[model samples]
Target: MPDIVEQHGVPVLVCEADGVSIGTVQDALDHLIGAAFTGAEVVAVPSPRLDDRFFDLSTGLAGDILQKFANYRLRLVVIGDIGRHLAASSALPDLVREANRGQDIWFLPDLDALADRLGPDGAGRKTG
Candidate 1:
Protein backbone atom coordinates (compact mmCIF):
# COMPACT_ATOMS: atom_id res chain seq x y z
CA MET A 1 0.00 0.00 0.00
CA PRO A 2 1.05 3.59 -0.58
CA ASP A 3 1.69 6.00 2.25
CA ILE A 4 -0.77 8.75 3.03
CA VAL A 5 0.58 12.00 4.41
CA GLU A 6 -0.27 15.66 4.63
CA GLN A 7 1.71 18.36 2.89
CA HIS A 8 0.74 21.88 3.85
CA GLY A 9 -2.65 20.54 4.93
CA VAL A 10 -3.34 18.69 1.68
CA PRO A 11 -3.76 14.96 1.75
CA VAL A 12 -1.35 13.16 -0.55
CA LEU A 13 -0.96 9.50 -1.39
CA VAL A 14 2.64 8.75 -2.14
CA CYS A 15 3.00 5.60 -4.24
CA GLU A 16 5.61 3.13 -3.19
CA ALA A 17 8.53 2.59 -5.53
CA ASP A 18 8.11 -1.20 -5.42
CA GLY A 19 4.40 -1.24 -6.14
CA VAL A 20 2.78 -2.32 -9.39
CA SER A 21 3.92 -0.41 -12.43
CA ILE A 22 1.38 1.63 -14.36
CA GLY A 23 1.64 0.51 -17.97
CA THR A 24 -2.02 0.92 -18.90
CA VAL A 25 -5.02 3.16 -18.41
CA GLN A 26 -6.52 0.62 -16.03
CA ASP A 27 -3.42 0.92 -13.90
CA ALA A 28 -3.93 4.66 -13.62
CA LEU A 29 -7.56 4.23 -12.60
CA ASP A 30 -6.56 1.71 -10.00
CA HIS A 31 -4.23 4.23 -8.44
CA LEU A 32 -6.88 6.90 -8.58
CA ILE A 33 -9.16 4.66 -6.61
CA GLY A 34 -6.38 4.11 -4.15
CA ALA A 35 -6.13 7.84 -3.65
CA ALA A 36 -9.85 8.21 -3.18
CA PHE A 37 -9.92 5.48 -0.57
CA THR A 38 -7.11 7.20 1.28
CA GLY A 39 -8.89 10.55 1.15
CA ALA A 40 -5.98 12.01 -0.69
CA GLU A 41 -6.39 15.14 -2.76
CA VAL A 42 -3.18 14.33 -4.58
CA VAL A 43 -1.52 11.18 -5.85
CA ALA A 44 2.24 11.17 -6.16
CA VAL A 45 3.50 8.32 -8.31
CA PRO A 46 7.13 7.39 -8.46
CA SER A 47 8.73 7.53 -11.89
CA PRO A 48 9.46 3.82 -11.97
CA ARG A 49 5.77 3.08 -11.57
CA LEU A 50 5.21 4.59 -15.00
CA ASP A 51 5.98 2.42 -18.00
CA ASP A 52 8.09 3.71 -20.86
CA ARG A 53 4.98 3.87 -23.02
CA PHE A 54 3.62 6.65 -20.79
CA PHE A 55 6.55 8.83 -21.81
CA ASP A 56 6.01 8.11 -25.47
CA LEU A 57 3.65 10.75 -26.83
CA SER A 58 2.75 8.58 -29.82
CA THR A 59 1.25 5.94 -27.52
CA GLY A 60 -1.42 8.34 -26.22
CA LEU A 61 -1.31 6.38 -22.97
CA ALA A 62 -0.23 9.39 -20.95
CA GLY A 63 -3.21 11.43 -22.07
CA ASP A 64 -5.63 8.59 -21.43
CA ILE A 65 -4.25 8.01 -17.95
CA LEU A 66 -3.99 11.65 -16.93
CA GLN A 67 -7.53 12.26 -18.12
CA LYS A 68 -8.74 9.69 -15.63
CA PHE A 69 -7.11 11.60 -12.80
CA ALA A 70 -8.56 14.90 -13.92
CA ASN A 71 -12.01 13.44 -14.43
CA TYR A 72 -11.86 11.97 -10.95
CA ARG A 73 -11.05 15.43 -9.59
CA LEU A 74 -7.75 14.40 -8.08
CA ARG A 75 -4.31 15.91 -8.61
CA LEU A 76 -1.42 13.83 -9.91
CA VAL A 77 2.30 14.41 -9.63
CA VAL A 78 4.70 12.10 -11.43
CA ILE A 79 7.88 12.26 -9.35
CA GLY A 80 11.40 11.47 -10.55
CA ASP A 81 13.70 11.95 -13.49
CA ILE A 82 12.23 11.73 -16.97
CA GLY A 83 15.25 13.15 -18.74
CA ARG A 84 15.83 10.03 -20.82
CA HIS A 85 12.23 9.85 -22.00
CA LEU A 86 12.22 13.57 -22.69
CA ALA A 87 15.26 13.09 -24.90
CA ALA A 88 13.51 10.43 -26.98
CA SER A 89 10.29 12.32 -27.70
CA SER A 90 9.81 15.60 -29.52
CA ALA A 91 6.39 16.52 -28.11
CA LEU A 92 6.82 15.19 -24.57
CA PRO A 93 9.03 18.06 -23.46
CA ASP A 94 6.36 20.51 -24.46
CA LEU A 95 3.75 18.46 -22.66
CA VAL A 96 5.79 18.38 -19.46
CA ARG A 97 6.43 22.08 -19.63
CA GLU A 98 2.74 22.74 -20.04
CA ALA A 99 1.65 20.27 -17.39
CA ASN A 100 3.94 21.76 -14.78
CA ARG A 101 2.33 25.07 -15.46
CA GLY A 102 -1.07 23.67 -14.50
CA GLN A 103 -2.57 22.35 -11.28
CA ASP A 104 -4.30 19.02 -11.86
CA ILE A 105 -1.19 17.28 -13.17
CA TRP A 106 2.52 17.90 -12.79
CA PHE A 107 5.81 16.30 -13.79
CA LEU A 108 8.01 17.07 -10.84
CA PRO A 109 11.59 16.08 -10.17
CA ASP A 110 11.20 15.16 -6.49
CA LEU A 111 9.08 15.21 -3.34
CA ASP A 112 10.40 18.63 -2.40
CA ALA A 113 9.07 20.01 -5.64
CA LEU A 114 5.73 18.47 -4.80
CA ALA A 115 5.74 20.35 -1.47
CA ASP A 116 6.57 23.57 -3.24
CA ARG A 117 3.77 23.05 -5.72
CA LEU A 118 1.36 22.30 -2.90
CA GLY A 119 2.44 25.67 -1.53
CA PRO A 120 2.62 26.96 2.02
CA ASP A 121 -1.13 26.83 2.52
CA GLY A 122 -1.85 23.83 0.23
CA ALA A 123 -3.81 25.87 -2.31
CA GLY A 124 -1.10 25.23 -4.93
CA ARG A 125 -0.84 27.74 -7.75
CA LYS A 126 -4.34 27.74 -9.25
CA THR A 127 -6.49 25.98 -6.65
CA GLY A 128 -8.75 23.03 -7.40
Candidate 2:
Protein backbone atom coordinates (compact mmCIF):
# COMPACT_ATOMS: atom_id res chain seq x y z
CA MET A 1 0.00 0.00 0.00
CA PRO A 2 1.86 3.03 -1.29
CA ASP A 3 0.97 6.51 -0.12
CA ILE A 4 0.80 9.78 -1.99
CA VAL A 5 3.58 12.29 -1.45
CA GLU A 6 3.23 16.03 -1.47
CA GLN A 7 5.14 17.36 -4.41
CA HIS A 8 5.43 21.12 -4.06
CA GLY A 9 2.43 20.86 -1.70
CA VAL A 10 0.38 19.13 -4.39
CA PRO A 11 -0.69 15.55 -3.74
CA VAL A 12 1.12 13.41 -6.31
CA LEU A 13 0.64 9.65 -6.62
CA VAL A 14 3.57 7.99 -8.29
CA CYS A 15 2.20 4.80 -9.89
CA GLU A 16 4.64 1.98 -9.40
CA ALA A 17 3.15 -0.21 -12.13
CA ASP A 18 2.15 -0.59 -15.76
CA GLY A 19 -1.14 1.16 -15.02
CA VAL A 20 -3.48 1.91 -12.14
CA SER A 21 -6.57 0.02 -11.08
CA ILE A 22 -9.94 1.45 -10.10
CA GLY A 23 -9.24 0.72 -6.45
CA THR A 24 -5.97 2.64 -6.66
CA VAL A 25 -7.63 5.60 -8.33
CA GLN A 26 -10.37 5.63 -5.71
CA ASP A 27 -7.83 5.58 -2.94
CA ALA A 28 -5.89 8.39 -4.53
CA LEU A 29 -8.98 10.47 -5.09
CA ASP A 30 -9.93 9.91 -1.49
CA HIS A 31 -6.54 11.15 -0.37
CA LEU A 32 -6.55 14.21 -2.61
CA ILE A 33 -10.15 15.14 -2.06
CA GLY A 34 -9.65 14.71 1.66
CA ALA A 35 -6.75 17.15 1.34
CA ALA A 36 -9.15 19.60 -0.34
CA PHE A 37 -8.18 19.03 -3.95
CA THR A 38 -10.21 21.29 -6.22
CA GLY A 39 -10.35 18.65 -8.98
CA ALA A 40 -8.50 21.05 -11.29
CA GLU A 41 -5.28 19.00 -11.23
CA VAL A 42 -3.98 15.65 -9.96
CA VAL A 43 -1.04 13.34 -9.45
CA ALA A 44 0.70 11.92 -12.52
CA VAL A 45 1.35 8.22 -12.95
CA PRO A 46 5.08 8.31 -13.68
CA SER A 47 5.80 5.24 -15.75
CA PRO A 48 7.12 4.18 -19.15
CA ARG A 49 5.99 0.60 -18.79
CA LEU A 50 2.24 0.63 -19.29
CA ASP A 51 -0.11 -2.35 -18.90
CA ASP A 52 0.04 -4.75 -21.81
CA ARG A 53 -2.05 -3.79 -24.88
CA PHE A 54 -3.19 -0.46 -26.27
CA PHE A 55 -5.51 1.19 -28.86
CA ASP A 56 -8.85 -0.03 -27.58
CA LEU A 57 -9.65 1.90 -24.44
CA SER A 58 -12.32 -0.72 -23.69
CA THR A 59 -12.36 -4.15 -22.08
CA GLY A 60 -9.38 -5.84 -20.46
CA LEU A 61 -7.46 -4.48 -17.48
CA ALA A 62 -6.08 -1.54 -19.44
CA GLY A 63 -9.57 -0.46 -20.31
CA ASP A 64 -10.48 -0.59 -16.65
CA ILE A 65 -7.65 1.81 -15.90
CA LEU A 66 -8.69 4.20 -18.67
CA GLN A 67 -12.32 4.06 -17.67
CA LYS A 68 -11.43 4.88 -14.08
CA PHE A 69 -9.58 7.99 -15.16
CA ALA A 70 -12.27 8.99 -17.62
CA ASN A 71 -14.90 8.67 -14.94
CA TYR A 72 -13.02 10.59 -12.24
CA ARG A 73 -11.82 13.44 -14.44
CA LEU A 74 -8.40 12.53 -13.20
CA ARG A 75 -5.40 13.71 -15.15
CA LEU A 76 -3.00 10.98 -16.23
CA VAL A 77 0.57 11.12 -17.46
CA VAL A 78 2.37 8.14 -18.94
CA ILE A 79 5.95 9.27 -18.76
CA GLY A 80 8.49 7.10 -20.54
CA ASP A 81 10.06 5.84 -23.76
CA ILE A 82 7.00 5.14 -25.93
CA GLY A 83 8.89 4.38 -29.08
CA ARG A 84 8.00 0.74 -28.69
CA HIS A 85 4.38 1.70 -28.42
CA LEU A 86 4.61 3.85 -31.52
CA ALA A 87 6.07 0.95 -33.42
CA ALA A 88 3.29 -1.38 -32.29
CA SER A 89 0.15 0.49 -33.35
CA SER A 90 -0.66 3.64 -35.27
CA ALA A 91 -3.83 4.11 -33.23
CA LEU A 92 -1.80 4.08 -30.02
CA PRO A 93 0.63 6.56 -31.50
CA ASP A 94 -2.23 8.82 -32.44
CA LEU A 95 -3.82 8.40 -29.05
CA VAL A 96 -0.57 9.23 -27.32
CA ARG A 97 -0.04 12.25 -29.54
CA GLU A 98 -3.57 13.47 -28.95
CA ALA A 99 -3.33 12.81 -25.21
CA ASN A 100 -0.06 14.74 -25.02
CA ARG A 101 -1.76 17.74 -26.55
CA GLY A 102 -4.49 17.74 -23.94
CA GLN A 103 -4.11 19.02 -20.37
CA ASP A 104 -5.69 15.98 -18.77
CA ILE A 105 -3.88 13.10 -20.42
CA TRP A 106 -0.21 13.25 -21.33
CA PHE A 107 2.38 10.86 -22.74
CA LEU A 108 5.65 12.44 -21.88
CA PRO A 109 9.16 11.18 -22.52
CA ASP A 110 10.37 11.44 -18.95
CA LEU A 111 9.91 12.94 -15.47
CA ASP A 112 12.18 15.95 -16.08
CA ALA A 113 10.08 16.72 -19.12
CA LEU A 114 6.93 16.47 -17.02
CA ALA A 115 8.38 18.64 -14.24
CA ASP A 116 9.57 21.19 -16.77
CA ARG A 117 6.21 21.19 -18.53
CA LEU A 118 4.23 21.53 -15.32
CA GLY A 119 6.50 24.36 -14.11
CA PRO A 120 6.75 22.61 -10.76
CA ASP A 121 10.00 24.43 -10.01
CA GLY A 122 8.25 27.83 -10.02
CA ALA A 123 10.90 29.06 -12.46
CA GLY A 124 8.37 29.69 -15.23
CA ARG A 125 10.08 27.33 -17.64
CA LYS A 126 8.48 27.18 -21.07
CA THR A 127 6.55 23.95 -21.77
CA GLY A 128 7.41 22.40 -25.07
Candidate 3:
Protein backbone atom coordinates (compact mmCIF):
# COMPACT_ATOMS: atom_id res chain seq x y z
CA MET A 1 0.00 0.00 0.00
CA PRO A 2 1.05 3.60 -0.58
CA ASP A 3 0.82 6.38 1.94
CA ILE A 4 -0.83 9.63 1.06
CA VAL A 5 0.93 12.55 2.72
CA GLU A 6 0.99 16.26 2.25
CA GLN A 7 4.47 17.42 1.26
CA HIS A 8 5.01 21.06 0.47
CA GLY A 9 1.22 21.42 0.49
CA VAL A 10 0.92 18.87 -2.28
CA PRO A 11 -0.92 15.62 -1.83
CA VAL A 12 1.67 12.99 -2.69
CA LEU A 13 1.26 9.23 -2.83
CA VAL A 14 4.50 7.82 -1.48
CA CYS A 15 5.17 4.20 -2.39
CA GLU A 16 6.56 1.91 0.24
CA ALA A 17 10.27 1.21 -0.16
CA ASP A 18 9.94 -2.46 0.68
CA GLY A 19 6.93 -3.02 -1.54
CA VAL A 20 6.94 -5.08 -4.71
CA SER A 21 9.05 -3.61 -7.43
CA ILE A 22 7.43 -2.36 -10.63
CA GLY A 23 8.62 -4.92 -13.19
CA THR A 24 6.39 -4.05 -16.10
CA VAL A 25 4.46 -1.27 -17.74
CA GLN A 26 1.24 -2.60 -16.25
CA ASP A 27 2.71 -2.38 -12.79
CA ALA A 28 3.61 1.23 -13.37
CA LEU A 29 0.11 1.90 -14.65
CA ASP A 30 -1.42 0.34 -11.58
CA HIS A 31 0.54 2.55 -9.24
CA LEU A 32 -0.15 5.70 -11.22
CA ILE A 33 -3.89 4.97 -11.54
CA GLY A 34 -4.17 4.02 -7.90
CA ALA A 35 -2.50 7.22 -6.85
CA ALA A 36 -4.92 9.22 -8.98
CA PHE A 37 -7.83 7.84 -6.98
CA THR A 38 -6.28 9.33 -3.87
CA GLY A 39 -6.28 12.73 -5.56
CA ALA A 40 -2.52 12.81 -5.37
CA GLU A 41 -0.65 14.84 -7.93
CA VAL A 42 2.69 13.20 -7.35
CA VAL A 43 3.80 9.60 -6.80
CA ALA A 44 7.02 9.16 -4.87
CA VAL A 45 8.60 5.77 -5.48
CA PRO A 46 11.72 4.62 -3.75
CA SER A 47 14.44 3.21 -6.00
CA PRO A 48 14.37 -0.08 -4.15
CA ARG A 49 10.84 -0.65 -5.42
CA LEU A 50 11.81 -0.23 -9.02
CA ASP A 51 12.63 -3.19 -11.20
CA ASP A 52 16.29 -3.72 -11.96
CA ARG A 53 15.45 -3.62 -15.63
CA PHE A 54 14.12 -0.11 -15.17
CA PHE A 55 17.67 1.00 -14.56
CA ASP A 56 18.99 -0.71 -17.68
CA LEU A 57 18.43 1.73 -20.47
CA SER A 58 18.47 -1.07 -23.03
CA THR A 59 15.30 -2.63 -21.58
CA GLY A 60 13.14 0.34 -22.59
CA LEU A 61 11.02 -0.28 -19.51
CA ALA A 62 11.98 3.04 -18.01
CA GLY A 63 10.91 4.93 -21.09
CA ASP A 64 7.61 3.10 -21.28
CA ILE A 65 6.87 3.67 -17.61
CA LEU A 66 7.78 7.33 -17.84
CA GLN A 67 5.62 7.72 -20.93
CA LYS A 68 2.61 6.34 -19.10
CA PHE A 69 3.05 8.84 -16.29
CA ALA A 70 3.48 11.64 -18.78
CA ASN A 71 0.41 10.59 -20.74
CA TYR A 72 -1.66 10.57 -17.57
CA ARG A 73 -0.20 13.88 -16.47
CA LEU A 74 1.07 12.44 -13.20
CA ARG A 75 4.30 13.51 -11.60
CA LEU A 76 6.69 10.73 -10.57
CA VAL A 77 9.55 11.09 -8.15
CA VAL A 78 12.06 8.25 -7.89
CA ILE A 79 13.76 8.61 -4.53
CA GLY A 80 16.89 6.98 -3.08
CA ASP A 81 20.36 6.39 -4.38
CA ILE A 82 20.68 5.06 -7.91
CA GLY A 83 24.40 5.69 -8.11
CA ARG A 84 25.34 2.09 -8.76
CA HIS A 85 22.88 1.76 -11.61
CA LEU A 86 23.85 5.08 -13.08
CA ALA A 87 27.48 4.15 -12.90
CA ALA A 88 26.81 1.10 -15.00
CA SER A 89 24.76 2.75 -17.70
CA SER A 90 26.26 5.38 -19.95
CA ALA A 91 22.94 6.81 -21.06
CA LEU A 92 21.02 6.56 -17.81
CA PRO A 93 22.90 9.32 -16.07
CA ASP A 94 22.10 11.71 -18.88
CA LEU A 95 18.48 10.62 -18.88
CA VAL A 96 18.23 11.15 -15.14
CA ARG A 97 19.87 14.52 -15.39
CA GLU A 98 17.44 15.63 -18.08
CA ALA A 99 14.43 14.30 -16.18
CA ASN A 100 15.48 16.15 -13.05
CA ARG A 101 15.29 19.46 -14.88
CA GLY A 102 11.63 18.95 -15.73
CA GLN A 103 8.58 19.37 -13.53
CA ASP A 104 6.79 16.15 -14.42
CA ILE A 105 9.41 13.69 -13.22
CA TRP A 106 12.38 13.78 -10.85
CA PHE A 107 15.09 11.53 -9.45
CA LEU A 108 15.96 12.49 -5.92
CA PRO A 109 18.14 11.05 -3.16
CA ASP A 110 15.46 11.03 -0.47
CA LEU A 111 12.19 12.44 0.79
CA ASP A 112 14.06 15.25 2.50
CA ALA A 113 15.60 16.30 -0.81
CA LEU A 114 12.14 16.25 -2.32
CA ALA A 115 10.83 18.47 0.45
CA ASP A 116 13.64 20.90 -0.11
CA ARG A 117 13.03 21.04 -3.85
CA LEU A 118 9.31 21.49 -3.31
CA GLY A 119 10.05 24.03 -0.58
CA PRO A 120 8.75 24.07 2.99
CA ASP A 121 5.22 24.70 1.80
CA GLY A 122 4.82 23.48 -1.74
CA ALA A 123 2.13 25.94 -2.76
CA GLY A 124 1.04 27.38 -6.07
CA ARG A 125 2.94 24.68 -7.93
CA LYS A 126 1.51 22.98 -10.98
CA THR A 127 1.12 19.28 -10.36
CA GLY A 128 1.70 17.59 -13.64
Stretches of model 3 off by over 4 angstroms after superposition = 120-124
Per TM-score, the best of the predicted structures is 1
- Candidate 2 regions exceeding 4 Å error are 1-3, 6-9, 17-41, 46-49, 55-64, 120-128
lDDT of every predicted structure (CA atoms) = 0.85, 0.53, 0.84
lDDT at 107 for candidate 2? 75
Q: Which lDDT tens digits does candidate 2 get at residues 1-128?
A: 33454445444555555444333434444543233243334545545334444433433544555566667756666667767657866467777767676666677776666666566653322245
Structural similarity to truth (TM-score) of each candidate: 0.92, 0.60, 0.90
TM-score of 2: 0.60
Q: Determine the C-alpha RMSD for candidate 2 after optimal superposition of all C-alphas.
A: 5.9
Ranking by TM-score: 1, 3, 2
Candidate 3's displacement at residue 117, Å, is: 1.4
- Residue 116 miss distance in model 3 (angstroms): 1.2
For candidate 3, lDDT tens digit of each residue in 10-31? 7788888887779999988876
